[model samples]
Every structure is written in C-alpha cells, then in structure tokens.
Target: MSKEFEIVREFEVDASPEQVWEAVTAGTGGWMWPMEEPEPREGGKGPFGSTVTAWDPPHRYVNRVENVEDIAEQSANQLDYTIEPREGGKRAWVRYVHSGILVEDWDNQYDAADKHTDFYLHTLREYLTRFAGRPVAFATFEDGPEASKSAAAFTAVGRALGLADDTAEGAKVRARGPEGQAFDAVVDYRNPYFIGLRTDTALIRLFGRNHWGYPVGISVHDFAPDADGKANETAWRGWLDGVFSA
Candidate 1:
C-alpha cells in the first residue's frame, strides 16, 4: 500500500534568508550531497531529474520529480523551501517540507527519512554558520562492512572516537582517527542517531543508521580551498574499516 508522508522543519538559523537560499539551491554539497546548481528560473532542471515548479530567490523554491522510470516505489517527490528574514535581516526563519509517497515498508522508510531530515538540516546550519559560500570537497563512504549492520555499531564507533555516551553538543572534543588523523573539533550537533563535528576545515557527519536496521555510514565536507574529495574518501574509508575491524 502506498502511503503519503510529509516531513516538515521550521527553524531559525544564523544566516540571512539569501544565504539560506544559496545553501539549499547551489551549496548543498557543503552539508548534504553534492547537488548541481539549479537554474534560477521556473521550469528549470532540479536535482534528481526534478523540475523546478517555483523559483523565488531568497524566499521560496520548489521542485518536483514524477514517475521516473528507474526510481521504484516512488511515484512522485517534491521539495519546498521557504525562507523568511529575521533579526532585521541578519538571520533566517526557514521552512523545509519534503512530501512523497512510499509503497513498501512505509513505517521504517519514513522513520529513517524523518531522522535524516534532522541531521541534514543541522548540517545546513553548520555550513551557514561557519563555511558559508566556501568551496566544498564532499566525500561519502557508503560501503560499510557487515559489522556496521549490528545495533551496537554506532556505540562501538563512539567508543572508538572517544565520545562519551553523555557527550553533548558544543563540547570541545579531541580524538584521533583510526589512521592517526587528528580531530580537534567542537561538537556541532548531537542526537542519539547522529553526531556532527565541526573543525576548522571540515564538517564530519556520523550517521547511525544501524538503529534503523541499516549499515552505519560517514560523510565529510571539506571546505578548504584545495580540499581533495577522493583523498578524503580514501582516508575516511581506512578510518571506517579500522574502526569496524577492531
């Protein structure tokens, strides 16, 4: 049975409305996946073969994908962003709505997607706060080993990273990656299912999908002017492997 689901988020961020618009439309890679810049007018190309239904800069943007042949179980998908200026235009009150239909495992899929929305939005704020308009080298390690599929996987990861169970956001953290890579960061965002670390050069996202019966994964957004995405991926892959194999 197909079920309709809508995930809504409304929050204030430390960026102007225009900056928020840029992050969602042209700067997704700094926080989420690398997305090509959308055309700045209606009826233009959007990510995932979606079509831009509305394009109002610094205020509203919308896109929709319908009936793509290769995308199974989903008949349509839409993303809408509404940005409002606040604090005398120094900050933004943003609303994000993702509505779609899922045909199978609706509960589990919606749960995972809902939680993902929180982490991604938190990453967006992280980008706007520190790395706005910076060039980003995005890297993702998706091929997790069998060990990362267990429910204890992320707890094990936190232990390896030296993050205590009670670690809270905004706490300064110092840890060494499995490859001896150093991390001296502030906890940017922390929830039971996700943790974000903000260093001078990168935003590190640790996804605890094992709680939802999926493999844990990691992503990095390097904002250095000469950041290398491939090299970052290689290094993080080694780190992930070392953590899980221990």
Candidate 2:
C-alpha cells in the first residue's frame, strides 16, 4: 500500500543564491550528513544515486530516483530546490519541495518527515549565518536500547544537559555532558522535538525522536579543521550510554 506525499516549504535566509546552491549540492555536511557531491548538470549524478532532472546554477535544481528497494517499494522520490537572491544578493529565498511515496507506516513516516524538514531548514540557516564554507565532520548517536523504549528518553537527555522546556533560542548555555564533555554554546534552534546548539566549532542537534516512537538521536556537525567524525561519534555514544544508565 504505497502512498504519495509532498512537502513544500518556502523560507528566506541570509545567504546569497550561490551560497544556497553550494550548500544544497556540495556543503550538506554542515547541516545534514555528508552526501555524494552532485554533478552540476542535468542528467548527471545526484545524492543517493538519484539522477539530476534539472540543474540551473544558483537558481534551480531537481533530482529524482525510482525504485530504491531499501528506501521505497516501487516509488518515485524527488527533491526540488529553487533559490532566488534578495537584498542585492546578500540573502536568498528558497523553495524546497520533497515529493515521494511511502510504502508502509505512512502516517508515522509523514509526521517524521514534516517535522524533520523544519529542523533541517533551521539548521541550514544557522550554517549559512555562522559557519558557511567551513568543512564539517558529521556524526550521529542514538539512545541506548533501554532508553529508546522510554517515553521520556529525550526529556531525560535534556535534563542531563541542563535544558529547561522553555530554553529560548540564542540563549547562552554552559553544560557538561554525562562524560564531562563541556558545551559553551548558544541555543540556535529549539522545538518540542528538536534542539540545536551552536558552539565555536560545532552545530549539535538533539532529536526527541522518542516522541515519534523512535530512539532519541544526536547529530554533530563539527567544523574545526581537525575535527574527526569517528572520535565525535565515539564520545557522544559514551555520553548517551552514561545518560541512559544513570
């Protein structure tokens, strides 16, 4: 039972059209996971083995893939990005559309996608505003098995980080992780399901996926020149283990 879903979003950020294009195609690691660099022309390679359907530098890009067995069952997946420069090329407006088919658990999948889109776009804005052009080492961590089953998993993680439910964006935060990893950061983005912290060297995202019946997760986009993704993952996993065990 396949179902179609389309998500459309339009937002403005402080980045030039070129910058936005680069971020989507080449610099995804700053906000999202590292992706295979897409070839810059139509009919060329795209992320996740998708084919480029349309490519117009700094303005429009589209890619599509079909029947990726691991991702969908006999489904079409497409991503379209439209960027328009504004304010004398100092900023840009972006229109992003994600259309696809879900083969199972449609409601949960759609809900996750919808909320994740908001978080991703917010992170993109944070990247452009603060860490544009910096290389990123991305890493992710998930809640321990026991914690994943707990409805309060993310709430516990938040408490461990000294975060209150009303912690406002842009508030400076200084907290120590379970393993004593310190954060001298500013809250860049926050919602009931996600929270983002921006430190001098990293953009850290904490996911409250347990709210959606999944394990809570953490993603780090470390921008320091010497950042090591493996090290970051190991450290965070240990921290998460400590949180769950406590």
Candidate 3:
C-alpha cells in the first residue's frame, strides 16, 4: 500500500515577503534547515541533488525528498507565498504544502516520515517565524472591520499598508468582550502584482505558477492585549496610533 501524507502550514509575516523569503532560503545554516545532505538546486549535483527536485525563484520553491529508497519510499514538498494589504503598506502569508508517498515498505518508515517532516518544517519555521530571537505573531483567522473599533483601554492604531483596491481581501468586525479587555484583528491577503510580491491568488491559473508563485507577503494585526496577554484591539490600536502617527 502507498501511503501519502500532505501537510500545509500558513503564516502571516510582519515584514515583506522578500524579507521572509531570504530568511527561508537563507542558506542551510539555521536550526531548522529543511534541506538534507544535498545543496538544493534542480537536477544538479548539490547535497540535495536527487531529492531536491526544483527551485523556481521567489514564489514557489519545491522539494522532492527521498530517504534510503527501501527506507522512506518518496517525499514531496511545496512552498507558496502571497501578499495581503492591511492598514496601507503590505503584509504576507507563506503557505507551505508538504506531502510524500510510501510504497512497498510502508511500516518501516511510517513514523519516521512524520518525524522527519516535522523537524524539517521546524527548521525553516524557526528562522522565518521569528527574527532577533523574538517570536512574531500572525492572524490565522479574524472576524471584524479594522476601521471602527473600540480603543478605550483596549488601545488601537492604524496605518496604511499601501494603495490597494480589489486585491485587498479581508474581514472586518467589532466585538466586545465580557472579560478582561477587547480588541480587533484583521486577517488579510493581497494577490496583486505589487512591486515586491511573487504571486496573485486570483491568477492561480497557470500550473507552473503554483510552484513558483508563492506569496511575497503575509501580515497580521493586533490592536490590544487582554488579561491573557493576547491581542487586545483597543489597546494595540491606541499604541499604533500613538507610536507611528506621532
């Protein structure tokens, strides 16, 4: 039996996609370096030669990882990135798609495959996920408008990510809490051919593009932090207005 496993992880990065891409493809020196022994390039004699299937510039990079034939059957990895505008400028989300196949000898590397993939991602995520040893946060989901929100003790601020019209897709909602604090968070995505972007979700027509048109941007917003130290829209927004619009 051939068992295939697919894993997809999406992240909202504060900086531009280019910046995040650098940290991701920034050589194999970091803790969670995904590349194995081969130096990643397509059909070339690098460390990851045979396993490293493809490399398509910034957007979509891929990996055809294999471990000891009789050991792990076959493995495949996909990387996708895109930009979403919030406030005004830009933010990005890097969607990772990794999957693999196990044939003939399935049980041999069943569990190992899982572990290997986890560690592999952990490597890349550790770097692009954070910088200067600080853990950054991204919005996975949201439920309100970024414009009209309470900013009393919650604190809130606003900034233009850039100039966006239709490509700007996101949710906007304002909800009050009965607990410690209140806030609003926006989860957005941009699929336009912006100056520094790599792909556009709307034009996800071309097949090869999927492999190369990874996101150039991913962003998250926080307006405040509640008693639990989570994003409190009111407070965070206030802070943003005070700090940036000064």
Candidate 4:
C-alpha cells in the first residue's frame, strides 16, 4: 500500500512577521529556497510548477505540487508556511510542513528530506538575521557517487580546505580540488553547528548535522553573483564528493 509522509519544522526567527512574510514571498534573490519564486496568488505557479493554493500575507501561505520534480518515485508533495507575530511584534514564529506520498524507497526519501530541512531552515534564519535586504544569489551542489554520509565527513571537508577540526573564526583557508576547483577565504563564523566563510567573491556557509543517527550530508552555499555560480557549483559538488569518499 502507498503511504504518506510529512515533515514539520518550526523556527523562532529574530524578525517581525511582516519581515518574514516578505522574505518568504519575495521572488528569487530574497531567499535561498525555491529555485524560482511563485507568484503570490491562488493558482500561481511555484517552484517546479507547484501551485499556490492559498496566499494570506504575513500569515499563511501554501503550495501544492501535483507532480513532484527531480524525484521520479515521488508523485505529489506540498509545502506550507505559517508565520505568526511573537515577542510583541519584534520576532516571528514560523512553521513549515512538507508532506507527500511515497510509493517506493520511502526510507531514503524521508531521511533525505528530514536531514535537508534543518539546513534549509537554518539558511532562512541566516538570511533574515543578516542579509534581509541585500542583493544575493544562492547556489547548491549535490554530492556524486563517492559521497559518504558518515561522522568523518565534516573533518574530511575541513582537511580538504587545510583547516583543522577546531578551525576558528578569522582563520585563513585555502582549498583545491579536481577540475580546477579552488577556494580562498577567511573564516567569518565557526562553531560546531555551522561554519561561514567569506571570500572576495562570495559568502559560503557549511552546515554539519546528524540526522537519523548518521551524518546527514555536506552542503555549501555561495551567496554571490550568478555569473560564476554554475562553474562553482559543479566544482564544489565534485570536490565534496571526492572529499567524503577519501
């Protein structure tokens, strides 16, 4: 029998409801998620052609997908965002739900979503907290066949960049990989949770988290112009896969 799966996440954002709403609905360049922005109206088109089922400014927005994209096994999915005022209007409470039906490989699909939700939400918080109105471009790279979802993945990435496990903020980092992939940056923020690197060309963020008892995966965000993003994405994707496999 086909089964349904739902993933829910809630975040306390240090921004007002209006701010959060604007950030969520504003088209590309405002936030990192949604490869493309959906028009904010009923029946408007969303990422991967999802339809906007409901749109209520600064309060509730819903998107439903009848045909899932990028995944052949999953047929349907929906994303819902509920924003509420909190801290007497100084902050916002955000709830996110991603649900769908799975007919095969449910474990892997669910786990992937479960792990990725944290990174996505974290990215949203960072955008709202620091770069709300700034012009930005976000790029994502997926690991290749050599990728590993293990505890040592994080250390491997740091080492690939010539950084120690305890690398701290302000530290200099240089990394090189296959296909002429290279990065030079100074650590902007560092902690066990996440690491932010700043270069002359872009702001890069790396996340390390365990999901479902295993290191989920590694992702790098390049908040820069799109001119160089495609090449960077290809390079980083191959480099990360190689690092984890090593």
The TM-scores, one per candidate, come to 0.94, 0.94, 0.37, 0.73
Per-residue accuracy of model 2 over 121-225 as CA lDDT, tens digit each: 999998989899988899986655567557777777777788887788889999666468676888888877888888898998988888777787889999999
- Where in model 3 is the C-alpha error above 4 Å? 34-47, 51-54, 65-90, 104-126, 129-246
Expressed as tens digits, the lDDT of each residue in 1-246 for candidate 3 is 777766666666565566555555554333232234434466643234344455554554555545434333554323333334333425556677656665646554444444444444433443443441332332211222333223311112112322233323344323222232333422222232211111111010100111122212111221112221234334333433333332
Residue 37, model 4: lDDT of 74
Task: Name the 10 consecutive residues with the lowest summed lDDT in model 3.
Answer: 201-210
Model 3 score (lDDT): 0.36
Q: Which pairs clash in the backbone of model 2?
A: none
Candidate 1 per-residue lDDT, tens place, 139-206, comes to 99766777898978888887778789888999998966747866798988888788888889999888
True-structure RMSD for candidate 2: 1.7
Expressed as tens digits, the lDDT of each residue in 33-86 for candidate 4 is: 436677878889877779999888889999889778787768889989999999
| Pairs with steric clashes in candidate 4 | none
| 2 against 3, candidate with superior lDDT | 2
Query: Which model, 1 or 2, shows the larger lDDT?
Result: 1
The per-model lDDT (C-alpha) reads 0.86, 0.85, 0.36, 0.69
Q: Once model 1 is optimally superposed onto the true structure by TM-score, how far is the C-alpha of residue 88 displaced, in angstroms?
A: 2.5
Superior by lDDT: candidate 1 or candidate 3: 1
RMSD in angstroms between candidate 4 and the native structure over all alpha carbons:
4.7
Stretches off by above 4 angstroms in model 2 are: 72-74, 142-146
Ranking by lDDT: 1, 2, 4, 3
Candidate 1 clash pair list: none
